[model samples]
Target: MTSAVHYKTAWEDPATRQAWRRTAMFRCAALLGWLLGFPTWLFAVVMTPTWLLVLWLPVLWVGIWYTLLAMVAVTTLRGIRRVLRVYPWQVDIAEVRAKKKGSTQFVVPVPERPEKSVSLGYGGLLGTGQHFWVRAMKSGEVTSAWFAGDPRYVGVVATPGPRNLLWVAQREATDSRMSPRKRGVSPEARALARAAGARVGEG
Candidate 1:
């Protein structure tokens, strides 16, 4: 039998939580600024023919679209970097268990009503209905367990292995229990899993 290694999920520790809060606050502020500024800038561009001919509305729209896309891309990259910086530990998974239906509640900022909204709220707005519970073991003993709804993250758990037992189980669970609409994982996620050395089933 292969030895099991322990893994710690993101935002599990106090330091991680603090780091996440800082980064999240910054991100929210950036998002709010963009939300407020983008429309105003677009309106100015549309109304002011001196900036660009009003006849070139299509070009202006395309430019705006690409600019928004770039902003999103930059923000995503920064978030990824921040996450990596905050949680520097390499997670090693021992086993994974899949749930046909699972739910978890987490907190998120309500941009429109930040002052009125509570910081900690309920519901799985950011998560998928499906869940995978993963256990990481160290020295033949379990250390930590994490819940994930995204197949890609689940793939990360299944990556380090003497054998990919979790992948087999995941495939079986997905096929037998999931509805047709939610039967398969996304191609992108599957590809990512494969790249990370995790075995993934066909979508």
Candidate 2:
């Protein structure tokens, strides 16, 4: 949990934006999952006569499809609500105390607000050396967690360190925020600056 005094929600801009884009992509796969369900169901009916198999197939598909839909709705709304917002302070860091189920989930503890410990599963333990395909019930060992967005419900991300999307975005933002010449300013801006210099020299 490398929650720095500078972190808090300060990295929210990039975190939420990236989260939305990733969530959109994930939902696209969910759409595919939905479409494939028909064939998969047919296959189950034709190739597997076991009553238990047929009974569970649809149940599993519906569960996964609905879960993905819920995720899409949640992330999209959160992104819309706080995409442009930035925080310049600090707070308690969230913890990833669960496994990733094809996506990241978080659990942010809140014990003092006269309410339940808020924030739920998102990102999982990184550098855990565990194969992503392995469906382990446990999250292995979570050493660090970095979160962005609202701490209450919309904690958009919980990436473990050395792989923080917000950190990556921050670096890119830093590069972009450099001097105009270093960042390769637009030609129009250069022209305007030259004209301003000419006027100043004439004076």
Candidate 3:
């Protein structure tokens, strides 16, 4: 079910960009990478069997972090380049697929192909990380999609905030490893599955 109230986002402007830069750099890009990458590396090394089996695990582990850092650099540079160029803000209606403490996920209007638009999988927040860890909550803000035009700023969240909310937010990709069968397209099916799983666990 979709929320009846729609949120309007702030327009991309100087203040909005400032807010975005601080959040992106300190919270997500540089700091977050180092914090997560180091711990992950340590965990892998400490784990007894997993690393031993994957013999070259140490080399691979360092390489993984290097790759992540490189990606962070490239993405930052690209976004900077995009910001330099002017693009029309394409504000379109998006379905509030998932809502979490700090982030919101939604499907943007595929103007060219309406059929390709996301109308499923948002039945509930099961896979959306609603209760999971997210930094956006600390600031009482969310990043929907940055540099992609203020899509109503954030189609999913209609909360009152900066008019340029989109300037600071980017739609972080979601985990889609689960099979379609497990995703459960409709809400009722998902509910039933959860109930069954609960009953099984009780046994």
User: Which tens-of-lDDT digit does each residue in 52-93 have in candidate 2?
Assistant: 685867666665656565454444543432422443222326
Number of the top candidate by lDDT? 2
Clashing pairs in 2: 1-144, 104-122, 104-123, 105-121, 105-122, 105-123, 106-120, 106-121, 106-122
Ranking by TM-score: 2, 3, 1
Q: What is the lDDT of candidate 1?
A: 0.35
Q: What order do you get sorting by lDDT, best first?
A: 2, 3, 1
For candidate 3, the clash count comes to 7
Predicted structure 3, TM vs. truth: 0.33
Candidate 1 lands at a TM-score of: 0.30
Evaluation by lDDT, superior candidate among 2 and 3: 2
lDDT, candidate 3, residue 59? 60
Clashes of each: 0, 9, 7
What tens-digit string does per-residue lDDT give for candidate 1 at 1-203?
21222224333434434544554565566556656665776687767867575556665565555456435534543433333322222333222222223322122222233333211111132232322222222122333222222322221122322121121113422343543222334566455434433345446
TM-score per candidate, chains pooled: 0.30, 0.40, 0.33
lDDT of 3 by residue, 38-136 (tens): 666667668756547466465666656555654544454334324323232333354433444334455564333445554211212222233221334
Give the candidate number with the greatest TM-score: 2
After superposing candidate 2, which stretches have Cα over 4 Å from the reference? 1-16, 43-92, 98-137, 160-203
